[model samples]
Structures are given as C-alpha cells and as structure tokens.
Target chain A: MEKENIRYSELERLCKEFRKTILKIITEAGSGHPGGSLSVVEILTTLYYLHLNHNPKNPFDDKRDRVVLSKGHSCPALYVILAELGYFDKQELHNLRKVNSILQGHPARVYNGGDEVKFVPGIEVSTGSLGYGLSVAVGMALGFKMDNKQNLVFAICSDGEHQEGSIWEAIMFAGFKQLDNLIEIVDYNKLQQESRIDDSVSLEPLKEKYISFNWQVYEVDGHKISELDTALADAKKYKGKPKVIIAHTVKGKGVSFMENNVDWHGKAPSKELLEQALKELEGK
Target chain B: MVTVLEYKPSREGLGEALLEIADQYPQLVAIGADTANSTSLGKFAKKYPERFVNVGIAEQNAVGIAVGLSLVGKLPVVSTYAMFLAGRCWEEIRQSVCYNYSNVKLVGTHAGLTVGPDGASHQILEDIALMRVLPNMSVIVPSDANEAKVAVKKSLEKVGAVYIRLSREKLPVFTSPEEDFVIGKAKLLREGSDCGIISCGVMVYESLVAAEILEKQGINCRVINMHTVKPIDTEAIINTAKKCKCIVTCEEHQVYGGLGSAVAEVVIKNYPVPQRFVGIKDKFGESGPAEGLMLKYGLKAQHIVETVKEVIKYK
Candidate 1:
C-alpha cells in the first residue's frame, strides 16, 4: 500500500493540534462527543498522516483507502483531519453541527438539501447508528476484492458499538469470506453514553471473540501514535483474513480533568473548560 | 377484462430480472440474508456466483453491506423476507441506504398475508409504511410477475434507493412484458367512469376481477396498477378522482399506511374525492393457506366490489 512519509514527531504534533481543533469546534457547536473524539485522535492521525493511501485532491479515486467512522459521534476528529489534509476548507470546521453545515453531528456522505447542507467530501458513508459502519466496511472490502483491487478499508469502531448484534453478523461475513483488505480499529475506551461498557453490556474476551470468527486480532495502546502506526502497517501485510486492532484508549484522553471521564462522552466543553483544555493541550 | 397470461411468484420475476439485467449492469451485485431460494435469488446466485453474496440470516448486515457495495460503484440488490428486511433492519435501511442516497435496490419478498402459513411474525404488512416514510427512498410494489420483472430492470437503470415489494405465492400475470415500468407511474388496466379502483401488488389482479364484476352490473370501474407506492402517480390519481364518482384503494398491506393511505393522502389533498380502503384492517395476519388468507382477510375481488359500491353511495 502507498503511504505518506510523515515522521513520528510530526504525527505527535498533529495529534495535539487535532485535539485542540476538535475541542474548539465542539465548544463552538454547543453539543458534541468530546470523549470518544479525544480518544481516537491518535488512531485517526496515524492513519491519515502516515498509513492511508488517500488524496484530498482526488477524494473519489478508485484506489484510495476507504475509512468509515463507525463510532460516528466522534466525527470531530475525522472532520479536523480531512480539513487539514485539504479535502475541504478548514473554515467549514467552525460550523460543526450548525444548521446548513456539511459537518454533521454524525458522519454523513450525502446531505439532503432540505437543511441547506450538501454532501461532505471524503466521508465514506453515512453512519451514526452503531454497528452499521463495520458492515459497510465489509461490503467495501468485498467489493475491492471482487474487482481485484488492492485498496484497503479501515473501519474505526467503538467498544460500546460491539454490543449491537449486527456487528457480529458483519464480523462473521468478513471472516467467512476472508476479507484481508479490511482492518478495524476499535477505540476501546470502555465507556458508553450513560455508563461504563463493562457495567452496561460487557464485551469481555473481545480478542478471543474476533479470533473465533477467523480475524487476525491485535491489542495496542490507542493513544500512542507509534503503536497505532506499527499495528496498521503490520495488519496490512498479513493476508487471507481480516484484521482488528483493539486500541485501548482513555475517553477524553489529552485533557487532565476529562481523561477516562464518562461525563465528557457526549457533552461539549464549556467556555471555561475550553480555555483550560486548550491550555493543557498546548502545555503538553 | 385484461388477458391473464400465466401464474408466477413475483419473487421469481425479480430473480429472473436480475439474471436478465446482469449483462447490462456489470457493477450489479445481489446480497441475500439466507433467503436466497425463498426470495428467488438462488437462480442469480447459481449463474453469477461471483457477484452474488449470501450474508446468512442477518438482514441488518445484508442492508449495511449493500450500502457499502453501492458506495464503491456497485449497484447492490438486497433481498429477504419483508418482515425481516423492512421490519427488522429498518434503521440500517434508513441510515445506510436512504440517508446516504446509496444506489441500492431493496427487494422485500413475501409481503403481507400472501406469505400465508408463516403467520403474523413472518408476514409483513407494514413494509410499505416503513419504507415510504424514509427520505430518499422509493417504494415499489409490483402487481404481478411480469411487472415485478420490469420493476427490477428499471430500478437498475435508475439511480438512488428503491424498495421493491414481492409476494411468495403465484399470481396471474395480467400486464405485458412490453409495457414500460416507469417509477411513480400507474398503469391503467381497465378503464371505467363510475368508480376508479387503485391497487398494487397481488391485489391488482383482484381489482381487475372486481372491475369486471362491476362492469356487468352497469358500474364502470377503472382499474390501475399502482406499482410505485412512493413518488406515487399523483397525476393519474387526480385524473381518476376527477373522472370517477368515487375511488377505492386496494392492497395486500395494512389499510393504515400502505396503498390506501398513499392514495388518500393524494385524493384528500389534490381532489378531495370520496374514497374507501380495501385492505387488511388493524390486525395481525394468522396462519392459513394463501387463498384462505386472502378470503379470510377480506382481500378478494368481492370485497373490493363492495367497497366501491359503498364509496359510490357517499359520492
């Protein structure tokens, strides 16, 4: 697979900047998921900057890597990266979740003109409802395999979303068909909207579960850009089976008060918290 | 009366149409959720093995996969029992297929009481209502095998999302293969002026029979095959309301949100004509033979004839 030659130091710096932008946009929008957005920043940054074979100039290229944000509430992270890569104007990020903004609360492909919003370029498919993105990624991987194309599909999922029965259904199909080009990065933050994942519906033995379905499973620290980069690279080389990286991450990773906090999962930072969070990110 | 050629399940029409249009649409793919033979996609699976996918008893995953296949320039056709496809995985259809405006064809087979022995749990009478409510989704209920085949072919020619409802049992093919199957266009089968009968799916044949029975009693009835339920033939409905004394809407679906409600939404707004609904009442379908189910549910031609007469009195 073709990859961009960005250094580890550069990816680290980009993750910090992406975190600040994600916080700013959510605070500006008045309501958004900050925890998951913060948790998956390193995972998305590593893929967009170093691992993915994608181009902002030709967003619809036949061979470009397709990334589906299955945990759709965390689209602020994706929106920031797509904009920084010049997929769209960065100014559009300020209008996140605003009426008539292309950046919806959830990742959307084509926006109906009813709300004065249109399609968002670089967004693979519309996904807000959980457990849908993986299946879609499976479909895309299947399509690429049928066409004999080498393009890979990267699906970023959340731990809570695995509770949906449809996710297992998709996993079974992808496993049975041996979709080698599909790689899923589960942001294992261990928390959902209202409660902890283990307290809610436990996804214990997660690694063994994927292995049972014939997936090449790996566990890594999601916040470490180096670990994510290495796992994604190694997974791409393995063939004859789909790959999944259970990226253990902290909800609201970068900020001191927000890290591992469930309250910040879907709540936007207040003006005071925004200033404090930005200062914490800059100091780091 | 129109010439009835042959009796065939509408699912066979859709399946055969998939085989026919495969050459024309090289990017076309079929996805099924363990209903390959039941939905009649088995023939396509056998011939075009590479392009066919059996996702196995998972309707939500089937729809989600179709959305992905469609995103990557493949015209994906997904089929399963209507009860599962429309009723079970409705959110997947809403977000993945309809919300994204994915060029995916959703074929809901064994719709309504026609599924017969499957009982209420298997028979889906609310698919039209569920599909029609979604934005960027076109709902199509074919009247017979020939029309169902045409619907599948035409759906591929067009872009965006479409829901094609089919039946399990064989019905008389009243329409010709040569007839053009335009989306949202109603086919006027029998022309009359006394009352206009609007029907879709298998009920179209029953409506034709009812029109014939009424014609003998000096009550001229116009029978229309309303194949496309959403993006409904508003113009034809207005014209029917204008020409006829009253209108009767017939379908194998529930009377609440299927063809009857679609026609009423048009008539009450566009022409404000007197209308009667001839469909399943607010109730679940019980297990029975197809013919007995039709009669027990009051879905026969006689019921339609009676509804037309009752509505004509109001007119």
Candidate 2:
C-alpha cells in the first residue's frame, strides 16, 4: 500500500479505539458529555494522528500545531486522544473526574501526578466554557502567522456555540484577517442538553452562513474516515481564507441506547449501562 | 525610539509602545474592536500588519482571541474601549484571560470620565472595580505618557493576565523617561508627613497638584501613585500611614471599589488610620465636558485638598 493509503487505515483504527476509550472513561466518571465526544472522535483522531504536527514527548514543542477545544463540556473525547498521544499515562484514564485527580469536571491546567508536568503539551488551554474555542484558535493562528510558522491552528466548537454573538464576531474577524492557516470543526450533533438545536435555536443555513462570512465551508459525515480526510484536504486547499468543517454527526455514535440521545449530554452511564457499553465496544 | 514633544494622551503612548513590542517580539499581537483609531492601535496595525487583528466592535471576541494566542505560547495584547472591554466582555476577560491564566495583556483605553464627548455610555467608571476583583489579573492605571509606555511594556513581559487602563486625555508627564516602573510597586512622586494622598491615572497628576497646596498650608501631605490596583502595595500603604498618620485616596471612579477602597482595605487591615475617599460618590455621571464632570463628581485636585483637610481635622 502507498504511504498515504497505509496512514489512512491506521487513523481509522485509531478513531474506533478512541471511541471505545471515550465511552469507558465517561461511563467510569459517571458524569460527562458522551454524545458530543463520540460525535467528534474522527475529527480528533485525524488531527492527532495525521493533520497536526505534534510530538507526544515534547507536548510544548514550539512548532507544534495547536488544537483548541471550544466545546469544552465534551472533553472526554479530547482527553482520550491526549492520553493516547502520550500526554499522560493511560492508567490515569480510570482516575478521571475523581477527587484530587488532575482531570476534573472540565479540562483544567492542573499538575499531573507522575510526570512533574504543570501543563501537558497536547492539551493547549484549560477550557469548558462554550463559544470561546474559535477565538483562541484565531489568536493562535495569528501568532503562528506573526512568527512566520506554517503550522495550522485547529479548533473544535459546537453548533450550540454558534448561537453566541461572540462566536460570530470571531468568525468575521478570522475571515477579515484572511487567516488561511486556521481551521474550525463544528460538531453538528443536532442536540444540546435538554433540547434539539433546531428547537432550541436554529443554526440553519449553517454552511451558507459560514460561506458568507468568507470561510470555506466543508460539510462531511464526521464519523467516516474518508469524508473526514477529504474535508480537511479541502480546507487546506484554500490558501487565503479560514475554513469551517461542518461535520454532521449523531450525538452518541456507537452504543445503541445513548446514540442520538440528548439525555447523554452530561448524564453518565449507569453501572448496568456501563457493562453493556463495555461489552458492545469490546465485541468490536 | 521616537521622541515626543509636549503632552500626548496615554493611549498614544500605549499605541507606540505596543508597535515597538510587536517589533521586538514577533509573538506580540494586538486584537481590538473597530476602535483601533480611538485606541491608537492603528500605528501598531500599520507597523506589524501581520500581528494586528481588528475584531470589529466585538469585545468578547477580542478577549477570546487573546487567550487562544497565549495558549499557543504567543503573547497577545488585546485592545478595546474601556466601557466594552470591562462592561460588555468582562466574562470573557474573566474566563479566557484570568481563569485560564493566559498571558493576555488587555489594554483598556478611554477609561474614566476623561473620554469626554463619547458621553457617559462610552466612559467606563466601573473598570477599576471590575479589574481589581478578578483573580490573577494585574490591574494597572498609568499616570502619564512615559508611565503608560513603561506599564504597557511591563504588562507584556509579565507572565500572567494584565489590564492596563489608558487615559484618553493629554496630561503632563509624571515619571521621568529613565525611571523604572515596577509591577505592583507604588511610586512616590513627592514626600511629606501630614496626610498621604494615594492616586492613579491622570488623577496622580491631580494628587501632585494637591500636594503643593497642602505643603503651602503647612499640611505637608505625601503623594504616592498607587497605579497597580491588584497585588496592591500594602507595604507602601503601611509605610505611608506610619509616616503621614492619615490617608486620602482620589480616583476617576466610584468611591466603592476603585482606588479608594483598594487603599482602604490595605490600610484597615495593616495600619489603623482615618481614610477619606475622593471619587465618584457611587453615582452614574452625566454627559458633559470632562473638566466639568471631574469638578462636579469631586474627582479633582481641589477635591483631594478638601478631603485632606477633612481627614486632617478628624486626626
């Protein structure tokens, strides 16, 4: 197989593994946003495995590409990826959201116990607040541009986060500056906590909304590896404007009961549900 | 290294210093609303075109971008009008900048009633109160052009979130060009022994004027520039109280959490002294000339003199 072809399947495998890991950690923690985490697993996996130029050991590598988590509530997904990427020991995954663990309700800049690390490299900023990731992404992109580095800044926000006027302000500013090196991934999970996004606040004409703001919009099935790669490739093709990948995805992707459900927004799986989820994931 | 003649607004000093810092460090980028001209960031925008980000009238967005840049190991200087940066986008300033401990320098221009014609809506009276209350946020109010330049540079070099309140009006230079402006240290412009007058922003100059009148009246008041409100110089306040016996604080903000309250908190805790506050008396100001507003609100050198006399009577 060609190098690109070999790398593609490797990333696909990583995505599946990441999905299983996210489910395990969230089920153990007993309180997390699983649906959103599962929805963006492919985007996170692809960025970690292929797209972003980052080193697992030297997390703060000066030239490493930055990834901002705008939808911070859905951190179980990114936490799994960072662990797989070697930010910390995989053993720490089970200790997540426990008292005194570095991993808290939301991702924070806490001192990890084993590594003598104050802030892990792969984890860029401590975040959980909504409608903020894109702005930080713009800041990082502008910083790289200022330093004449060619690395791109990727941010993962949510459809609900788009309802924020601040998010649009960042979008327009990123568009106005023509920051081609910036890429934003909006996980259109269709459901926010307690309500469907359309019923809550319509983000309709979403793709056109981004296109009008001068962002190159790329819509794709966020779970499919091929679609994920193609969308990212297309975003990179545009060299003079920022790009937004509107990945249409189900809320909870893998497990049956949690799939496409708003109840899984921050509700952890029950002990019985956890056993069932682990059985299905392990069977795969 | 451009030299200036006569008086210049503190915001102009900030604009020039920022461009110099951006030139010195490639990572220093400035984000703003549509007020680049009013904030005087247009020069920085022109000089380092790649580093300037105009977020068009969105204060919340501007703060968010600054945090993102800091996470990527880049120093970001976010510029916006005082009213919006503190009043409108304060939550972003809190979460993104302070809570995250991002190395984001927030340059708040047109602070106080001195913003003048922009009216009460544009003027920010609660900024000092807001900034002083935030954790890990170093709040600075530079007294003059030289001090503004020094404070702006200091905020960029410091390793945490910082807020530098810039004045819109032109004022006489308080600090000499060669004087060092340390973070959290109070600058004593004049030394006396009856009453200690602590002030910040253009009001520092006002306090200096108040000192001269007090000296002639045998009041012998000591004036200290308490510029950095948070991590406030408690040691200096104690030192002033020990020497001067009484204290009076004057600022272009409410008497409630502005410079007065900041000083009073330190004095009451460390040294017991009679403290008089000369500021906006917990009221929203009306639209008028800046000078008229200062007099009406009792935020001037004369007000400081009267407060000093009143505190002296109590002593």
Candidate 3:
C-alpha cells in the first residue's frame, strides 16, 4: 500500500519549524547544546516525517521501527519532533530540564520516582553518555534480524562522539555481524563541545573507517532533504552490511551567527538572540 | 558430614542453565565478549546459534548491545571476564542498562582472585561495589555450581538488570540441586551461637569449612550463604548478628565493597555488633595458583576461622 510520497518542499518546511521549536525549548530551558541540535534538525525531520515506520499513538508498538538518539545532547530536536507528532502534549516541551520534569537534561527512561518515563513515545533507549546509543541500536538490529522481523533500527550520532572508543567497538560489532537492518546517521557538523572536532580529535578518513569495517558508507548534504531521503532508501535496500550516512553539515545550520561557531555548541540563546533567530527563521 | 559433589566452574553452570531454559524461554539470548569458551557459553552458542551473539572482545559494546536486545523484548545474557565487563563497561551498564531498567543479565565470570595466575589485571574485586551502587541493579554471587545455575535461571525469569558473578576455577559443589534458590533470601547453612560467619560466592563453602573447624575449638559458628549481594538478606544478617553477638563476613572479593560491606551495612544500621571481615584487605592479587592465591589473599577457610575468633573476642 503505497502512501502519498512526502514532497521535498514539505520536508524543508518541517525542518524550518523543527529548528524554530528546538531553539524555543533550548532557549526556554536557559541551557542546551544548540549547535548540534540545530545541525540535526533536517535529518530528524526527514526520519520522523518520512522514513521512520512509527505511530505516535502506539509508540511502544512491537512492530514499530526504533530510533536511538545517541547524541542525546541534541535531544531538543527529538523532543520537538515527538511533540509535533502527538507522542505527547506540546505543552510538556516547556518543562524541559526542569526539576521533576520527564524531559530530563539527558535522555532517560525513568524519572526520580522509578516510574517508566515516557516523556515522548518515540524516544527509544535512554542515551546521553557518548558511544552508547549505536551499540544499543546494533543490539536491536540483531534482535530484529534474529526474530526475522522486517522492522529497522536507526541511530543518530554526533561526529564528536566518534572519539569514544565504545562507538568504534559498536561499529566493529555491527560490521562483523552484518546487521543490514541497522542505519547510523552521523551529524558531521565538524564541531564538538568547546571546540571543533578536528581540534579536539580528528575523524578524518571517517568514511574510509566505516568502509574498512565492512559498512556501506554514504555521504550526503545533510541539509538537503532529497539527499537524506535517497541515502536512507539506499541504506534500507542494501543487504549483507550495516549502513552509515556521513551527512556533511554546518554546526548550527540555518542560524547565521551560530553556524560553524563552537561557542554555540552548548550555550542557549538569550531572549534578544532568540527573537533574532525566530525572525531569521520566519524570514520577517 | 556434608557430602560434596564433583567440582565444576560456576561459569559452566551458567552455560548449562541457559541451554536448559532455551525451550522454556524462547526469548533468552546469550552474548559473549570473545570469552564464550572461557565463560562456558560455547555450548549455548552451538545449541542456539541464532540466539547466541559473540560481540568479540568489546565489553562495552556487549553490555550496550544487551540493553538494545532487552529493549526489543529479548532477554539478553551478556558475559565476559569480570574485570572487563564490570570495570571497562561500568558506564555502559549504568547509563544503558540500569538507567533504562533494561532486562539484561550480566554474568561476570572469573571474578575475584580465583582468576589466579592471570594476576590482578584479570581479577575484579570491586564489581559488587560497582554494580550495587546503581539503581535497579540486582547483584548475585552464587555459592557454587548448583547455585550459579539456579541464579542464571532466576535472573532470566526476573525482569530488569542483574549482575551474576561467577568464578573460573572448579569449586566444590556445596549446594544441592533441590535447594530453594530465592533472589534476596540468604540460606543459613549452619546454626550456632558463638559467632556468625556470613559469606557468598566460593567463600560460602569456605565459611562452612570454617564452621566445622571452629566447632572443635569450642567456638560454635553459624554459617549463612548470602548469595544475593544487593537487596541483601538484611533479616538474616541482623538476626545472625543479634544471636551470635558477633559477626564475621567472608568473601572472595575485597573487604571494601563486597559481601563484607553489604553485611556490615545491614548490621550496623539494624543491630550494631562487633564484626571482622575476611577478604582482600586493599591488596591486589598476584600471579599464582588459585589455591595459593586464595591463601595469600586471605580468602581461605582459615582466614574465616581467624576472623571468627577475633570478632568473638569483641563480643
């Protein structure tokens, strides 16, 4: 049953809204990783609106595809997407990072009271610590493959997180296992917390590293919805290998002052800066 | 007289138990970090090839993968050397498994000085401390092969994160197959009045041997096999402390944060009693035979006997 194809213009419009909403929440929280969050808006928009086989009403459906946001610092993008998709109330976005709020500073599956914290339905495994989410995705892919389920598992990682040895460990594992059902998208914005990724730890020849690990590597313009769509489709169609899309993106994309600026890696925008960003986003 | 059965490494019990429950729990999956043969998971790997995953030598990925598998409704049992599984992947276990309350079973084989000959690098003395401090983590140190098998089965049946510490050496089979194995309950192996010798893992059998030795010295010692280290048998520890008027904790782990510390946490809060610990006293193990290492590290029955007498004097 072929549904209406998501037009590129529609995805681009959603991306702008996602960026605006992400900036709103992070600015309201008074602190968050804006650069990384802004960089991943288009990738998340395309995945949630088009690629992901999930239902917000049935977030925990056994047959639903899973997405693990490995770079949890960029959770503002995910939180906005989940809210926009009706996984939770849009009002809950305001409570992000507040005490006792389910929207923790980092992604978590439980609150302080020990109850299952489903701040948003699509938030899969809790991840904030770098180098963890990809391994979890690999495990889920293996589980799905073993059960012979057609469901897919996707993980979004930051370029800076590649420095964590555990990420390479998972990459090696996914490659060795030949987990074709897995797709990893690295937001290659070239910047990490406090500095550029190269200044901190270079991941040059990153695509070659994946190729050496037996992964099907794809590089694309991350901001271009068409390229992300095609790369994701190619990843889904390929067999006998896990796929990784090295999306070349500018850190803090779409926001002029924040673009490629490491200063915005974790800092939130002030009220005036937020107004300026909203004006720019709105083309007013 | 206690009739001891044939000796077997506790890791074998874990492997065999997984095989036994393969049919009953179809969702049970075993994962090894390049130590399938060493951890006795090769049998399960061969039997249920599809269900068993060898994540190579990456311990952090093993734990994180287990969390992912658990998230997708599969009960994953991840095993590796205790030093690596607990030490190298400590953050993964905390952030991925425990924080999410994922139903992943962590089996750390070759724990304590029993790893022997491999030296301090292979030995993991702080796993209990490492695991117990995390929320939603159940820690089990089975006394023998039989208890280890039962612990594996029980951990599989239960939901959430669990850490089961097993040994590399083949120890005496003190626990019977018919013994009731509960998660948090401590089994009183022997009853006495002079003092209480509470222990876990391979040290449980040593505590029993210490009890027999103490009997001839006119020091009637009670022996309690505290298998579950976290959510420990607080009632058993307090009752033993109150009855014996003194307590001695014996474990194959370090004195800082293992059975000794677990028992003391229960005793000092509920019933303060004079107690001594028989364990590695902040010293790392060296390359030697398993038996020699146990003696050098003060993990033998004799050490338990000496500590029993020392605590009794305070009583």
Please report the candidate that would top TM-score against the real structure.
Answer: 1
Runs in model 1 with CA error above 4 Å?
A: A1-6, A114-117
lDDT (C-alpha, whole model) for all candidates: 0.91, 0.83, 0.89
Predicted chain A of model 3: TM-score relative to the true chain A?
Answer: 0.95
TM-scores for all predictions: 0.97, 0.91, 0.97
lDDT (Cα, tens digit) per residue for candidate 1, span A127-161: 89888999999999998888888899999999999
- Tens digits of per-residue lDDT, candidate 3, B78-139, equal 99998999889899998999888789999999998988889999998889889989888999
DockQ for each model: 0.84, 0.57, 0.85
Model 3 earns a TM-score of 0.97
In candidate 3, stretches whose alpha carbon ends up further than 4 angstroms from where it belongs are A1-6, A112-120
Error (Å) of candidate 3 at residue A98 is 0.6
Which residue runs of candidate 2 sit more than 4 Å off their true CA positions?
A1-17, A109-117, B1-7, B19-23
